[model samples]
Target: MFSIASDSAKSVRYVLEHDHADPNESIGPQSALAFALTNEHLTQKLEIVKALLAHGADPASLRNPELNPPHRDSSVGDDSMLLSPPPTTTLEAMDPATRYFISRADAPQTRHLSTLLQKSLFRPLGGVRYDIVGQDQVFEQLFTVLNLHSRTLSVSPLVILLCGPSGHGKSFLARRFGPLLGVPTHTVNVTTLRSTHDLWDSYSMSPYEEITTRTLAQFLLENEGKRCVVVLDEIEKVEEPKVLYSLLMPWELGERVAGTCSPRAGHRHIDVRQVVWLGTSNIGHDFVFEFCETSSGMSVSHGEYLELARLVRPRVSQSLGASLSSRVTTVLPFVPFTEAELMAIATEAFYSLGGERAYFVSLDIVEHVSRKAIECYIPEEGARSLHRAISSLLMDMPEFLEQSNK
Candidate 1:
């Protein structure tokens, strides 16, 4: 019956009625819903799932029997099914199968199916509001690494250094990391400071110091007993290398003490043990671009690009200093956007500016702007120029709107 694809709904109903099959039956530790949700063939067949659900399928069924409570066999004539117990471990600690199911549930197309399931089934997995586009692999790695440390209660700070061309959303990626881990984020532009004291204190009580102190204190207090992501943007631009030492305490030991050179210098301490540090730079942007642009006209494969990144690590490390570079858990490279991604960005920008009228803008116009943007693309400048090109194209929206109304 399962072999028939087009008549899945009718087949499912027939099997359930005649074979007396339990809609929530386990097939190799996976419930029908779990198999249906994860199976690429079945996931898109919403009618099949609807048919199973109509036949009393329990959406709350889990793949791991260990995570579920002992239940009476419904096939033995008693139709009452016991409710599954809540997971004993955090979502990060759960087995891979469960995590995969959760990821599938989080998909936009499956949101309706998720809604039908009991909230308690998935509520243990904390919600993360991350809307950053592209770089799926980067986010996956970030979650795995951070979640591993979180589960182990490791003292070593989770530090990620993002190396990319300017305007490739390095800082934006850092900001998105906080919400994924259910934490707040604080960003500091490392280039603006002149000395180590500028990070935490100043001897003369300068305005910069006052503002920095207030922001630090507020963040520390508000996020007490919880993790926070601290983003140091453009670390390569810092004038004084000594100032970089301020990060070592929090990054390695998870605490920062006020230095003797400060205004509030009575041994003020900040408990930053739960802090995750994100540092961004454009130090080796040109090298990455040059390596990717081949004489044969074909773009570099992902594996080749990564290999090149490894080869250039020494250069980046030298520029940022060994001490800072050594502390970083991983240096993530954000590649330049492809033509398709640029077009998507341009379309998004048009929608942002034009609202409902965005649809009226012809595809030819969007493609033209996208092509011009790509032609003007400079690896060092990144997405900033593309965004500007889209903005410039939208400047004629009034005329387009008038013509559309006619």
Candidate 2:
């Protein structure tokens, strides 16, 4: 019955009505709701789960006991789940894991569910989950690109160039593509590779070799036939222009020379057709800022920003040379954080500090630091100055504590 319903919610309803199958009844360890939650087909799973929940399925029931117990039914009702209230100070101070459960208690399609589940279930246990704030449009575009790629039978990779100021979360966003898509991410710092020799060796070295690449080649080899995101961080920082040329084949053609010594000797070719190539850059920040400044109150609409990105794409291509830049699918522009967004970041930073220290970190302090950051904000540096402002406040904590005691 469950097998028949795996692809159809109508079948599930029929099974429930005719077979007298309980929606809450455990199939193996998982209830119908839990089973639907585990379904790989997201659209079908969402539909089936919603149907089950409507038919008296308990979301709190769990297939795994070792994991945290099902969330209390405080937020759930006989008919619909209530909307989650805004985060309180207590909720803000809680760890991500706890917050995940609390937020999931009320809503099925909660904003944080995808990110939280990606961290908890998709990633390896105890992996760091980056908080990607204020990049909804980027995520939307990325999903669209991936979906389009998936629908095609082509062997070419999806190439994305992220253009933004330093420390505006471009690299972090690239790394996040892994969890979001349920694949491993391999990050290569382009600045670290000095020559083509470094490139060949880094891409082909084995576990026995001392100068082996971190995880790029190994992950590609192990996860052959699987999708992945390959992030080339700070591509603009690469010293050798020819090295960028060497990567052109891989970026455009999804074909790369696979050998330890050189491109000729033991050379075989490897294909990374299922990979997403993410290149991040701090170029064109000034141009974006200048364009935005000429707009109403220095705030550009998303459409206007995209238009600016289109203009900046040519400038970046001119700088990086036509060969490397012409193959880029799209250049995504990450704008600087607004003052309100910076304040939110500061508050989040304070909450992340945890325990007694987090309690002491007031909104007033966050506002003060965020205001300072707003004043000192530079288009080239982006949110780095804001982060530094927050860090400096934390560094002065001892002095503040001493003063408070007096």
Candidate 3:
């Protein structure tokens, strides 16, 4: 990383070419491309970026968005240089995946959004380490989806169904989707809606509660014509499958229907030309557990996932009905966490206690917390029990207690 940040371009090229260093690596919070641009000379900075890109560096930059937001007239010359299209020779050297995001056959007028998507999605890239673990297949699918969405102006809203057991990062992915694709994302709990009318008009859960405009229709109105993601979470929990009829128009036509059902909505049709219609459910999680009982909550093979997905579809079809189920473009099955993956999650949770990122927790404490969390894990319920296990163990620890008392 320092070699790229150094003034000598030869040092950067030599490491990537001869040493075969990973171009996508991050030294702490910054990606190699980000660190490279910090060099003193414009000539040297360009050289380092080209070297990194040639070596298959992700153009979806891991640079913090706050520092690099589409600066047009900056005093620094590197902004324009960094935004410039890579030389053809450099693009030729890049891997197909890296090349597709930045270099399109027909670069659209909205091509700049691709750069935004790159910088925003999977933020603080931390090399390849992500907050959400054990879901590489999910990430790869989204990477391509977001890239396509970024380049287009009026693609239909995509419906993706995430099917699996709970606490397996399904909700985490829903929340991450907002920043991951650089679009406004809204999540509606299908279980909470009283009727299709509740989508446009807010209703009280109880008599004491007042009405609010925080409905799905309002979310659509706010981000109308702009690319957005609306997560219909807990889709299987809705009482009547007919409630999902509200989704058909938006999912298929990129046009969210709003009638004069309520005074707030007042018969307005919202055009959601570019939107992601995401749904999460645990329809066929039982089959997953049955298949992976011997693996002890480890990994699932590609063939196994395919088999699981087939089993999942019929269950989703049963719950959502035929028409709604067919709208789902792809069903992604989130596999149960492996022992190592669970341990990593626990360690991260321990360190993140009291909103700190630094690893203040001791190695012994980390191991203990992680083991207790994993031990208490419920396969059926997923890793939701992990936090409770961790919290119970943490109360007696002095470091945790010190931070809590503060």
Candidate 4:
């Protein structure tokens, strides 16, 4: 295959034969242009470099401090010509999202590459949907919740209930939609907060107040005037349900809950309606399904689904303050993506890599891995497994090139 070639002419002929555009034609984020620059193999590197330039990499895009082409000393070979000059173009001119796909080709340190990539690919706190397919309705609903809390709009108290079975993508939806709605999304992992003091110290605030007040204070200081999307992941795990009441009160009441902190010494209020609160849980649906089947001696015509908000209400009321509990809304269950959707997500991952040389193991690959993960009741990790599989596959390509040299 072209990807395993040792020489430039053969790779070029492979591209011409296949009528490919860039090495990225095979992968979504990985590109031949970026790959060529990263590979240590001098001759293959030159070929891919020429191929990238011939295809579309702006000659001017390669430059120092900008796209610090690997140092000559770090190159795979002693070929001084390859390291003597830097590539000459800004990442902006290349396929911006996938440009850094090859940034680690000759990585001695991946920190620079990771930092550059985090800036380039997606914003911090911004969400990425790895393999989600066909959730236009979900996206629309999220946007609706976000638009309601827009600073530009004067909206009423609003609470969004995002519930779903594990691996159904509720968390992914909230994270991705937060930025679009112009609200910063914050995820609360109650398990990470061992004690009330742990919670207070975690946010660098006083334990005299509930965790929500402190969290809101910090969020407001940094992102004032912006609506915030709060994701309460795995609400079932909270040791104290009262905590939920404190967290949801402001959003429910459309006012901020004042804390005993140095600032806001007295009770103060914030517009709660401006912040969208999303809670996800997997607790109730199974109970509901079993109840329906046994009690009625027949299942409902429609399928049963659990809502986290309903399941955790008693706890939320107990942990959170009474005032906060009144402002909450029940969560809705999220629909799972179909098989076709999973395939589409895989396709997108490949497309994002730059497609040309990117190789997807196949639907069988996803099924083999996902089914195994599902059997373990950890479908969420399936995407990660797929990533590892692809990483393993691509890792073999460079090694193949190395063997060809022998």
Candidate closest to the true structure, highest lDDT:
3
Candidate 4 per-residue lDDT over residues 38-111, each given as its tens digit: 44443333335534533334333334333334445445565543543433233332221123322322222323
Query: Model 1 off-target regions past 4 Å?
Result: 1-130, 179-182, 202-213, 221-224, 259-269, 295-302, 362-369, 396-403
lDDT of 3: 0.59
lDDT of 2 by residue, 1-406 (tens): 3543457767775675455788777766555655555444433433354445434454456424422124334557657755332222123533332233333333443333333334332222111122444444454454445445545555776788988677777876776567545576766778788877565444522222235445566656666666776778788888987777776777777767665322465677676777778888887878867876776534456577668778989888877889889888778877765544555554454444432444333434544554654565554765666566656665765443233223
How much lDDT does each candidate structure score?
A: 0.56, 0.57, 0.59, 0.43
Candidate 3 segments exceeding 4 Å error: 1-129, 144-154, 202-214, 260-269, 294-297, 354-358, 396-406
Candidate order, lDDT descending: 3, 2, 1, 4
lDDT minimum window of 10 residues, candidate 1: 121-130
Superposed on all Cα atoms, model 2 deviates from the true structure by an RMSD in Å of: 12.0
RMSD of each: 15.0, 12.0, 14.0, 15.3
TM-scores of all models?
Answer: 0.60, 0.62, 0.61, 0.45
Question: Per-residue alpha-carbon lDDT of model 1 for 1-406, expressed as tens digits?
Answer: 2522433656775686566578767755566655554444432233455445545555456535542434444554657655443332123432222232344334553344323232322121122212333443344444445556755667776788888678777776665566444466667778777877676432212222223434544665567557776778787888887788766666666666644322345776666777777888887787767766752222445466556557556766898778777778877766665555555555455445555554444545545555655666565776677667656656844564343344
| Tens-place lDDT digits, model 3, residues 1-406 | 6686555667876786666678777766556665554433333443455456545566555334422233333445754634422222234433222233233211341233234346443332211213364564454444445555546633666778888888888877776666544576666767887777765564212222234546667767777877677777788898876676777776777776566332244456778766778788887788667766754345665456566677778888887888888877778877777666667666555544523322333345556667777887776766567766666666655465353333
Better by lDDT, candidate 4 or 3:
3
Output the better candidate (1/2) by lDDT. Answer: 2
Evaluated at residue 240, the lDDT of candidate 1 is 87
TM-score of 2: 0.62
| Candidate 1: residue 382 Cα off by (Å) | 1.9
